[model samples]
Target chain A: MDFQLTDEQRALQETARKYAREVIRPKAAYYDETAQFPLDLIEKGFELGLLNLAVPAEYGGLGLSHLDGVIATEELAWGCAGVATSMIANDLALLPILIGGTDEQKRRFVTPFTKELKFASFGLTEPGAGSDVAGMSTTLRREGDHYVLNGQKQFITNGEHASQYTVFATTDRSKRHKGITCVVIEGRPKGMTVGKHENKMGQRASNTVTLTFEDVRVPVENRIGEEGEGFRIAMETLDNSRPLTAIVATGIARAAMEHAIDYAKQRQQFGRPIAEFQGIQFMLADMGMQIQAARLLTYQSAWMLDQGQKNTLVSSYAKSFAADMAMKVTTDAVQVFGGYGYMKEYPVEKLMRDAKLIQIYEGTSQVQRIVIARELLR
Target chain B: MKILVTAKRVEDPESKIKVKPDGTGIVQEGLKYKINPFDEIAVEEGLRLVAKHGGEVVVVSIGGKEVHEQLRHALAMGAHKAVWVNHTGPLDQMGVAGLLQKVVEKEKPDLVILGKQSIDDDQNQVGQYLAEWLGWGQATFASKAESFDSENEKNKVPALVVGADNKTVRVVREVDGGLATVECQLPAVVTTDLRLNQPRYASLPGIMKAKSKPIEELIPAGLGVDVTPKLTVTKMSAPPARKAGIKVPDVATLVEKLKTEAKVI
Candidate 1:
């Protein structure tokens, strides 16, 4: 089978690579250190048509294929995982609109955000819900033409800065998964409060904050799907997003591997380059192999998405494999650094920290395993 | 009033180019090509002028087969139509200028826009040659553009006034020291610089619509233009790589090194 990227795909990849090298790479460390959002870079991303890749042509989006999105995401992550995370969070927030929102909703909410480079957040995880999305306790009760929302969401990327949110809440408490419903909440609506930012170990450039909904009112038209379809919507959104997370992981791992390889050649030990050592060479080889494998799996899952195939199994496989590989590769990169790896002066430590989150967010490695098992068992 | 913008496909601005071993030209294999950066500004300026004035914008390019990408890019930037004059191999500045003259004669547009120079050659001669061929007013290295009334044509009135009263274009050009602004009447050739308006990224719909925009092709012979190179390259070679210098502990040491070791300061 031909493995080379098509001309269009290669062009997108080259564009992303140029952006990563010129813009994102320069600001990554500063944003991580200060926990400041890279708003300027986000604007640049919008200018380059990197932000809303999957939104259709009719809505003024690039309508890039899923594989194209994955390729772009990987390159961005290679520059700065945190910045990449913050930028791609819009994809997650816009998924519900792409999947189920009405034309009016799409025009009002989705189009503005994508067209104007407005940041967005997805609110599914809560104070009580982490991996268990069904355990979310947020509620939306219908009252006349509006729905009153209650409860809080935590650890939301771009939560503090997003102009809009796609929030999941319970419409019927009696039924577990069937009770969940999705709503599009405006960021500055009455009774909505953005809590203090979460100080994380890495990916700090990405703003993770808690969102409190104390009787926040949303229009009934803002409901994404049927009353009990929140669970399905959330799952389908994850099905699209898991590959994205994998792409991010692949990016981080690729960066780490590239840094390690470069270091091995330049770093001298025992009057010779460390790359000459079998141990270091072996580490580099394994890192390269894992990154390539992870990239292939991630692209395959994205290709499956573009082809309209059932990607539940492939996405789970990619997410788990790439996330776990990123963690391993970054850790190995640190090992290659020896004493320098432990200090914040070196970037591998930061990479290690950034790689950790990929395994935790979207769907945890455990959750990915469960999905894979379910698919294989069937 | 119709405006024609000339475009050239060059190596992608972001790509690093290497010269061929034969010392004649740049190595073309595996290199990415894109709409010339300066030409993009020219296209954007043309579109903006057309948008402000009630007129049509058309893009014209003379190159090999790969030049169609640049034509499509102009179309995506809101140009109404495009024309491509295909040449099999590389064309020098004179050949390109001759072909462009043919296109200008065929289109008979009121205004012609082009980049000050293509990035690959950096000759900065095509616009002047085209202006000479067309016997039109010429403005080079424009940073900003405005339409105003021509002082000489104050007493004359056209049948239709689409934009300003006299159809005069005010242009800002970068000179040796700073910027100079000049006004020229219609039927002029204006070359663009980077300070011109930033070209808009083609939206998905615009790109799709550009596929259907009419693109007419013409050969040099068909256009009655002699396409022959007026200049020959003597040699080509890569610039030497900058050497990495030793790092000092602080600025004081660096200053000391610069003063003592380098001896230039």
Candidate 2:
């Protein structure tokens, strides 16, 4: 029932806050402008232990609580959503192995993550299938002690540089969801190719591309859990990952609200500070209210995950509410900035752009609503 | 070389401090405590010395049990051990310095470092008093510090390398209008300025390890030092509000205002 963070959690939060203020917040626009991956910043984050949030202690990870991880993500996201996305993408790739992989598989794939600032990806979502996990056509055929994978994954985050991937492929398409299996693979093997890199509207610092695995031979031991369980694994991974994304969403909303608040107080019009006008004051108030609400939902969901509770419904609620609120708040922030918010020189517009992705990734807003509805009906 | 450093817990520099309604103390409802910035510099300097020379850094703090947070922070910054002396403060500069001198006698470290001043009290006298009590050469307000031939046995501090050639540490301090460089032999005291080094962030691994590192707690009474306070605070108050700026049309008016209204001619 206590809402207070432990001293360690506070320390971790303070570290991320200082880092965001010193490193990420100032460089966000430049990284966005140049549309370059922040490799050095990523290294700095690893050094600060901001990365590897999900790894186990035996693997040299902090083994941070879900709420602690969320607190960190929120601070880092406040600095720059694009930069936060790039960092969290690594954890997104690691969660699957943690959830379903064998100890050997974890030791083999997950442990090395702490050793360096390397990227890994959760390989899901094909060109033809985004929300429909069963609609994937990637296939895996059994070979001697290996599974030969043949398929393509579109909008794969960190595709170009990820050293390993927890991939999804079907052993039998006719079995639908049951046909799916989780396979962990590594490197640019002979038959694997990294396809086109995407140029996106926001979160441009986060890399995304299409990866094609043609006759890529992965060892059988790399398979996570039993056969016919990939669908459940992916859903649970989303359940865990959605809250992290929700925290980032709430961060974007808070960042936008803060900028708007600053603007309202400083930007003079009609011979007075705009904040003096109820019209602008009310907007700022509403933005603050939404940011607070989103933060509560996001933090509650993260705490639930930490408590080992079933969180599909709440996770969806958090992701959708936070994303929608961020979009609204950031747009209102632009309004507070008047014409300047529309320009690249101002930070609110970039914040607005970054806010758009939260509703899109982890699950689109529409998909989240449907999941929430089904959970309610059940 | 074995180095000892002092860490002090103070209110975060950015936090607002206001007098209590009673005027006897500060408002404590929302104050965040952090290691004094200058102490962080002292810890960083000791850590750097240990990194270059084979040695251990021990951090000591004087306060209530809560001061362990600052001590753990020093350990997380890579100090090898910590000692906590449990005591509440009303101790003036001399009493606190006497306590530290007792610790130095027990630890017998080759080098002792302290922040030149604490942000909370701004009392810049503890290190000076400690050096006087110990009869050791003291270098205060050091902005930069380096050890010579640290890797070679010939220049190793006698504490760790007895019978070796004399080892020394060179330090530059900010003196009135300029910087002063001084070199001290082994078993000396050094006080750090803000420019000594930028303290590193405690990595997550470091934080976890610090949780397990031991802190040996002691009581001031057991040490048998007179820790009675010599000063009492009768009141606390916030700084005065800033006066709003005024513009004059010409230099004549500006000069007249400076000479008359402002009384600053």
Candidate 3:
């Protein structure tokens, strides 16, 4: 298969990169320092059709190829991972509709946001469950034509500002993983409460807040799929989202490399630019090499998705490898910076901090390894 | 009615271009190319016209094989079809305009739209030349276009073109001082500026569909026109770099420097 991006994919990548460098980068530090959401950046991404890259064209969204989505994600993450996480979460929220929603559901829930700049959140991880989908305790009980959901979801990206959410809750507690079901919850619905924003160490520009559902009533038609299919739906969602995460990791790594390369050329040590030193040169080479490999894997996984191939294994591989590579590359980038890397004044420190979350969330590094191992064993 | 929209692939509008070591053009290595900013507006206007007036919007371009990429982009932006006239060597404004005129004669589109000027050259001369060759109405620097039934003929719908007004097409041109609304007739060419519609992103399905849409290539002979350069570039050079200026301690010192040293204030 050809690895070259189609013209549209290339254009989307360029647009995203332009937005990242010109708009997002300038405001990143301020958002990080103040722990505030980058609303302007988010709006700009919406305007550029970067916010909801997955919502179908039928729903008024740009409906980019999975590969295009990954490219855009990488570019946005390059600018600011926190902001990227917050913005890209809209895709995660809309994945259920893309995968299983009826035509009416897509129009009502997905189309409105595409007409404007709106944020969405995916509610899967509860206070007690991070990587354990079967362990979720939220419940959606049917009552008449509606379902009343009572649960608490934590660590939700864009939780505070999202207009809608894709919330998963157990419909039948006896069936474990099979008992879970997904539903759409309006942000301002009755009995829905948004908690205080979490003060994250990195990606501070993204708001991670806890959402409390107290008898939150949602239309029964809002169930994403048939009963007992929540686990499968969730896995499928990750199958699409994992590549996006890998893209974000790739962006972080690229940003680190760029910053390190520029720093090496400008910052002088011992009567010469540090970039002239073989030690630093090797480090830069290694970073570039790993970043390239990660990008290829990430794009390949996205391409597989576009081709309608089963990409669970490949996506897991990309997510695990790219996230780990990002962490290492950013850390090494800090090393390239030496003392300056430790200071916030330099951008590498921020890149280092931002790179950490890619390995933690969207199926932690350990979880990704588990998936890869399971697939390989199979 | 059939319409033709011309677009160019240039350095991304947001990017700051640096002149190449060879003085002929800007450095393109590692730079991203996009539909020329003004051309995007023109494409959007074409699509809007088609959507409202009910017609097909075809995009035409004259460049290297890479022009197909921009053609596909226009198609994904909702153009009905694409025609790319491939040129191996660079063409001056007059030569490119000649090629476009040939395509216009072949397609016989009711209207032609293009960017007021390409970002790279900024010559702003191709549309005028093509309009003159076609002997059709020309409207330059159009920000909007609307079609309504002419008051004189209640039964006939007249396209309310907005930008430049000439012998035929009435356009509302943005002058150095203010805006001037002028009327023009059909079979006209309209060039766009920045204030036109914000072009929509090509949706994934649109991109996929564009791959299937026919993009016919016409060589100079295929269009029954001889392709020859009308203008030659003997030499090219880079603009001189800005000289370093002294930095002041604060706003007051900068004001003093501007007033006394530079003598501008």
Interface DockQ of each model: 0.14, 0.61, 0.16
Candidate 3 on B3-54: residue-level lDDT in tens? 8998787877666677767666677777767788888888888887777667
Model 1 misplaced regions, further than 4 Å = A1-26, A43-50, A57-64, A100-120, A139-150, A171-175, A186-192, A214-222, A254-289, A329-349, B13-16, B19-26, B51-56, B141-185, B192-212, B228-265
- Angstrom error of the Cα, residue B124, model 1: value is 3.4
For every model in order, the TM-score on chain A comes to 0.98, 0.98, 0.98
lDDT tens readout by residue for model 1, B152-202: 334433211233663677777878777677777778889988766567765
What TM-score does structure 3 among the candidates reach?
Answer: 0.77
**True-structure RMSD for candidate 3:** 7.0
For each candidate in turn, the TM-score is 0.80, 0.93, 0.77
Residue-level lDDT of model 2, residues A196-313, one tens digit each, is: 7698999988888998988999889989977889988999999988988998988888888888988888889999999999989889999989888888898899899889999999
Candidate 2: what lDDT?
Answer: 0.87
lDDT of 1 by residue, A1-378 (tens): 558786456556756887888789988989999998899988888877788777876676777789878988998999999999998999899988888888888888788865577888999998888888888889989999999999999999998888899999998777878999988987689899999889999898999999999989999988998898989988988889888899899999888888888788889999999999999989989999999999899888989988898799999999999999999999999999889888888889999999999999998999999999998998
Top model by DockQ, which number? 2
Candidate rank order under TM-score? 2, 1, 3
Rank by DockQ, highest first.
2, 3, 1
* Top TM-score prediction, candidate number: 2
Highest lDDT: give the candidate number.
2
Q: What is the lDDT of residue B110 in candidate 3?
A: 82
The CAPRI category of model 3 is incorrect
In candidate 3, stretches whose alpha carbon ends up further than 4 angstroms from where it belongs are: A56-64, A97-118, A140-148, A171-175, A187-189, A217-221, B1-5, B8-59, B74-82, B89-94, B104-217, B230-265
